[model samples]
Target: MSLEQGIVFSVLGITLAMFVWNRLRFDVVAMLALLAVAVAGLVPTEELFAGFGHPAVITVAAVLVISQGLVNGGVVDNIARLLGRIGHRPTLQVLTLTSVVALCSGFINNVGALALLMPVAIWMSREAGRSPSLLLMPLAFGSLLGGTMTLIGTPPNIIIASYRESGTFGLFDFAPVGVAITLAGIAFITLAGWRLTPRREENSADSKLFSVGEYVTELRIPADSPHAGSTLHSLLTTSGDEPDVVVLALIRGEQRLAAPSTYKVLREGDVLLVEADTTSLQTFLDTTGLELAHQAIDDQEAESEGASNNDGLADESRGRNGFRETNGHNDAVGAGDDKAASDPIAKGELHLVEAVIAPESSLVGQTANRLQLRENHQINIVAVARLGHRLKRRLGDIRFNAGDILLVQGFEDSLGGALAELGCLPLAERGLRLGSPRNTALASGIFLASIAVIVTGLLSAPVALVAAAVAMVLVKLLSAAEAYKAIDWSVIVLLAAMIPVGQAMESTGGAGLIAAQMLVLGENLSVASVLVMILVGTTLLSNVVNNAAAAIVVAPIALSLAGELQIASDAVLMAVAVGASCAFMTPIGHQSNALVMEPGGYQFGDYWRLGLPLTVIVTVVAVPVIMLVWT
Candidate 1:
């Protein structure tokens, strides 16, 4: 082999290893490979960054923005509401849910499609008295199947289409093979595949998906309370049959003491920030005679107002407990008419919501205090659950991770928007806007028009989709900030960096070498066997690395193999596309899988119970379909 080929192969090998290691971000690894190829003189410096402006990258970003607009315009919310009416039969529910998700996957970003619909799936499972495990995996897999049906449905398809020399593949070029495989795969899961999923029992009360054992709230000592002068340790000792609650902090007038000493004396009107389950919280309140801080504030306000009306005292007088009162409000506990107007808890508008952190959430590495969640969003992180394990760290100190289940407390009116801005997916049914008919009609019209323009050959996929995204912003379907935030920059970077590296593999004959070796392995086999080999290889690669990277690396090899065997390259490239989108075996294989892991109470081994058989079904169905459609 030439030295350039050797260097390219070495770099490619390391890149694959890094991707599998998964310690570094995939984009960082792709960038490292790009620099290695450029340093080896395999690619010119001028072309090193050209992949950034590639049509495939642009299309992926545009699709993500448009997907966000569709979500903002209430298209998916309306569909979810309709889905709630599907009957309680598990098979029928799985069939209908998977079918709808797959259909949506064809038009929008598959991960986005899965995220939006996941809560619906969870709600369905709950309503039917079944574990979410039965529906979540199938929903995620259905998204993968749906992405195969259209050229713009998946990043891998876009990358594969760009490999063609006769301009990129048309919008519907993939439909014949993709639709057949999708139909077959969805049918299998709906009939028998869902049964293979493990039914993990969630530890819940009142049919809630997440455990409410660690909810944190504040309790205030009344002036006449029996335990007002007790020590902190003594108070805990006497409050319950056992110490089922923990005092996290002591809130004195203007000072907050975290983990206060056991001997610290509790005084009248002192607030104790404690964590306990619902049952235990009630028991503690019943035993200690302490009132909820907010309730005490209200009671005090009524008494102070009564005194002012009867004696004509000033409204700003101090209460007996040394709390400054103004207009029947307490300054000590930070409650007033102004605060009550905005603070949901003060107005009895509080709701405890359970949500899973999205993979692309801005909250992934932030703590509650660092994000100022209570200050900015008026939400409190009451408890957190991770991978079926309850977290014991203090709320403000626990760093958020993707897939972490958070029990957040906030006002019902504005909580949905806050969670959306924080990139969280609520597990419970939320009040999603059904959208004014005009907004929905406008957004849907723009999306369909872009597709129509692409079908009629008026514009390329990237240009048409980008124009649609811009139009969505113009119509206020999505704000400028929302449009920018919708694009997953990590994916964009990975695609742009890996594109040149893929070209380097082909330019240096590395892909040809690999193709030659594969042909030798299948020396006496028919062309169909070679096609299966390519598909299977790409599927395995995608299960380890990003699907787009898998397609970029394997497309050239499939084309080279087709050339050697004297067959149409279209069939082989189609195999690569189908294979790259079938990453159902592991959570690391796809973002859709990871997104459902914690919420579904899935273990790493739980995926292949359904994923392995589904993969076999996809391969058995995809090969012949591709051959018949393209050959």
Candidate 2:
């Protein structure tokens, strides 16, 4: 190999190794690889940032925005709600939810589609008294399958299209193949997926997916607060906001009343136990100066890790300094430390909440700058995920999407309503049903119109989708907020950053060296065997590395392998695409999978039992299908 190629290859190789070891973040690794390429003299330093401006990158970012718009528009939430009312049979519930997921993913973002439906799946598992393991894997897997049947269904397809920018761009050219694979995959899941899952048998009853040692705490509405003059009913009506924060008891000096009336007048020192999101609860605490007799916020993070036996009070020291009464000393909050700056809800009563931001909120692509999510609402967007790809940057600049899972820390008395007003719905198991059942006819009508415009070549796919988005917005079918909330920004960043790296590798002859190695190893093996091997490699790597990164890393090698075998590069590329998106084995592998983890009360080991077999089924089924049809 030439000097430049060897250097690039070594850097890429080590980066892949780090990714596999699961230590450093993939985006950080990609950025480092980009820098190494520039230093190795393969890529021009001036041209190094060029990849960040790629079409795939912009499309991914824009798509996240569009997905957010769709979500804020309320079309997806409407459909998800319909799926929720599908009754208590575990088999029927999984089948129904998966079916809905497939339909939603086909026209829009698959990851976004799954994000809307996962909470419903959790609810079904809890209500049916079945393991969430029975449904979430399938729901997640179904979303991946659903993306196959349409042009705009998934970002990878968009990236693939950008690669073939000058192709005829027929909508159905790939649809038939996708439809066949998706149907076969879903059928396999419906018939055998649930049985493969191991149940998480928790001692707590299944009906309550989330219930802690929460006491009925009270707050005093100060004269200087926002609710000073508001009616008792208006201030206490958190039912529309948070159902878990029940208004169980209200106390005024000597008299303690159960379920205080909405008309009751509010004065100082009124105690209430109202179920609320951390945001809402925080708003309440700061706005009303509420105090808790017992604070469980310190110990809840461990609960997220599934350690329920540790009493909420036993280990205040293991938590942050804010709750370290056991140590009898509070450390100073240093201005210079990064940790201090990063803690959004550092002061006041701390509440950690994981809320699912819908794909349709106007929040997508927005830095907390436009939203001021913390300053105005008193909540922080700590971490966000676009399906399996997680954000590695600041919570402020990371951008929001519909299906993005946000790890937010705030005071419950302060920020709940603002989150809801922003069109973000809590995924923490709520009483909210899908706002309304999906108008299948309207959904079908608008979606088909969008497709027709694209297929007939009347308009570009983006333009057509936008038209449908407008109609959905105007008709009150989908709100402007839902539309913006649906886009996945992390995937956009991963795709944007890594696409150039692939080009650099190819340009540097790194692709040739990798291809030579792959082909020589496969030497006399049949093309089919080689294809399966590539698919297998991608599948194994995806479970460990971020899948988008996994795809970008292998695309060059797969195309190289194809060249060596004298076969269609597209065929091998398709294998890489399929393999990278097929994660099911671990919660860490996919967001839909992880979203269900705590709610499902699943043991981490349970995934392999179901996921391993499902994966094998996908491989066994995908190879023959890809070879027969695509070839």
lDDT of each: 0.82, 0.61
The window of 10 residues in a row where model 1 has the poorest summed lDDT is 311-320
Cα TM-score of candidate 1: 0.83
- Per-residue alpha-carbon lDDT of candidate 1 for residues 113-135, written as tens digits (9 for 90 to 100): 89888988887787777889889
Winner by TM-score: 1
Off by over 4 Å in 1: 202-205, 209-218, 221-348
Residue 379 in candidate 2, Cα distance off native in Å: 7.5
lDDT, candidate 2, residue 347? 38
Q: How many backbone clashes does candidate 2 have?
A: 66
